[model samples]
Target: MFDIRLRIPSWHRLHSFLGLGASLFFAFMFLTGTLLVFAPELDWLRYSEVRASPQGSAKLSLGTIYDAAARARPDWDIVTLVRSEGAWFADQVTGVRPEGRDAFLWVNPYTGQVNGETSSFTIHAALLRLHEALFIPGRLGKLVVTVFAIPLTATVIAGLFLYRRFWTGFFRWPRFSSRSRAWLSDLHRLIAVWSLVFFVPLVVTSLWYMVETVGLNAPATPANRTVARDQLLPPDFNGARLDAASAIAAATLPGLEVRKVILPRRPAQPIVFQGDHTAVLVRPRANAVYFHPESLEVLGAHRGEDLSLHQRIAEAADPIHFGTWGGLPTRILWGLFGVGLTALAVIGIIIHAKRVGIMQQKIAGASARSGFARVWRGMGPWGLGGWLSVGLVVTGLALLTRNFLGA
Candidate 1:
């Protein structure tokens, strides 16, 4: 059933429907996403050290960062600190706050200094929200984006069909001296040809990402974890001791360093510690060691990297979406993609507008020749419906992509 929808130029029809409503918002998303493509460079410009990963270089133990955080908020549980592009930022969770305060503080890669507290993550964050759902609260954002994606995909496909004469139309520049409409079509086609090269890959990747992130195949948790998988690191549930800490270190955590020990505030939970493998870049990289809460005794360890294949792929969507793997080169590519796409959208409409004017002129001339009776008869069922269907879908697709995919 779904495959049947793909047979027609459905994406094109969708573009027309959503484009009119969301043109402005999508333009904003495109511009911001484009600029953000160089965010690592931008962040480097803002903060100097680019100190490259928080694994081995430790003066800032998880304990110390936790301590610093404990001092600052005193009442929040650490909700996993993000280690990305060599910078450490905390996403500490607080109890009373309605919206968790995004307490972004820099950690000393070597010194363990938790520096700077700021409430202004908005500069980098606002556009992110608008990019996703225009900041709509819930399922509305999801539904709108999904609907948009179909058309966006369609527009690109239809665009290729609509402009089938690639070579002749590809490089032709608009004559400024010509009528405004003539110029608009020329300009539109020119921009579309150029931008489409970069825009298509980016748009398709983004489409895959949108569907992937909201998908169901996440990593299996501890309950579903297997012995073959967990052997690399023992499970740490505070359930039983992995012998004692030193003994467990000898048996379970061989060849790796115990970077930081997360002391437990509760007896029932385990004292969790992570492993450091400076060598393997793609290794699950962090492993959990469980210990008795009171004795600080090692219980068992779990290898975070050893997950089922589908789970690993599912986990990759966020990094892929953020372009974290290929690093700066990826960002630059995506950044250019954003710019090219915005140009396409703007130029797409201009071309559409120009063609409509030409069609109108032709229709009027045909009316004169055929008389109103014949013209009306032609328009009666098929002619009007064709224009309406094509226009509606094309415009709809644009808006939906902007609202959902672009977001």
Candidate 2:
């Protein structure tokens, strides 16, 4: 009889190696992601100027707001005006300054006053960059981050396989009176079992990101008509037609709540009115209307309902992954689970370290004489080498990205 067990790799060792190898990176991502869940609110809390009194309705027109932003920053080329979702939130007007850097001005819709300004590198932007690419620059960084989905998915499967009866552990509590290792293991399993709901969707969305990053499952975009150079608006255009264009957009798409107004920057660009309609899970940009830059004439419109199946799924990915589909409650739930995932990584590391310490205590020969040799023995040659390699690669990539961005 063939010994099938002999050919199979040790699932326990594989699980530990996979989990440990990416645990630090996973913790970092989880922390940053959790912060991003309430990024807007964080900024609102930090910057008092972004806060506004709850007005029943907007007192000023979109054109007035645009003019106010332009007057506030005369040197900048106003690019977008994002409408506030809440009455107490200030509308955002973003513009490109010299050297192509963006500046955001918070304008009170009720008064058309520019409350304050911030650079493009706000806390949210910095955290998003770190979460998406670890600040490693272009497509390469994105690919590197997305590729981790493979190991992460594998680790989850291996974990579930190791604890085949994970469902039974849902109601089980960790024994506080037990040894530290035993309690830690119990807590780890308990958290993992409870977090299965979040983990499944997280893994699915992460894999989708990997697919998209590699250009495998590209989503279809609406075909845009190019504007001629001769049709471009003059530099001194005051955006007086913005109010009329917005009204036209609202009439074009019934029930459309315009969230963002993207202004044209170049001759071949159109003013874009991006918003949400009755679409359930799609993004604001999913439903949009385009207009001629100078004429304010309707060019085309895209309904969220008109999206293909693949495109709908792609559109839903971010909302699902970030738990934004359900508003505040889901975001809170996602943040809690994110903390749980972070704890799992930390607990897994502690558990492994304790186990390794026990193994080292039993080895009392010359091989464990020096601190380096002891660490080598404790982690094993492969484990130490893998950690070292990851550290070096991450450091090098960070430096390279910094230099690239600087240049």
Residues 223-277, model 2: lDDT tens digits: 4656567634566567578888888999999889888998767778888899889
For all candidates in order, the CA lDDT equals: 0.50, 0.80
- Listed per model in order, the count of residue pairs whose N, CA or C atoms clash below 3 Å is 36, 0
Instruction: Supply the TM-score for candidate 1.
Output: 0.57
**What is residue 318's positional error in candidate 2, in angstroms?**
0.8
With a 3 Å backbone cut-off (N, CA, C), the pairs that clash in candidate 2 are none
lDDT of 1 by residue, 1-407 (tens): 36864666554444453443344445555665676666545554565333334455544434455445556554443433434434443322112222544345445544555554443342345445545654556656544554555555665666676677755776687888998867876776676677666556546646655665466435444531222331222334221332245346545756545544444333244545555533222223345566554445556665546656555555454445555456568667667667766775665555455555456667755433332323222322544523543454444446545544433
Over the full model, what C-alpha lDDT does candidate 1 score relative to the true structure? 0.50
Off by over 4 Å in 1: 1-25, 35-64, 67-78, 86-102, 165-220, 223-305, 357-407
lDDT for 390 in candidate 1 is 41
Clashes of 2: 0
Weakest lDDT window of 10 consecutive positions for candidate 1: 224-233
Supply the global lDDT for candidate 2: 0.80
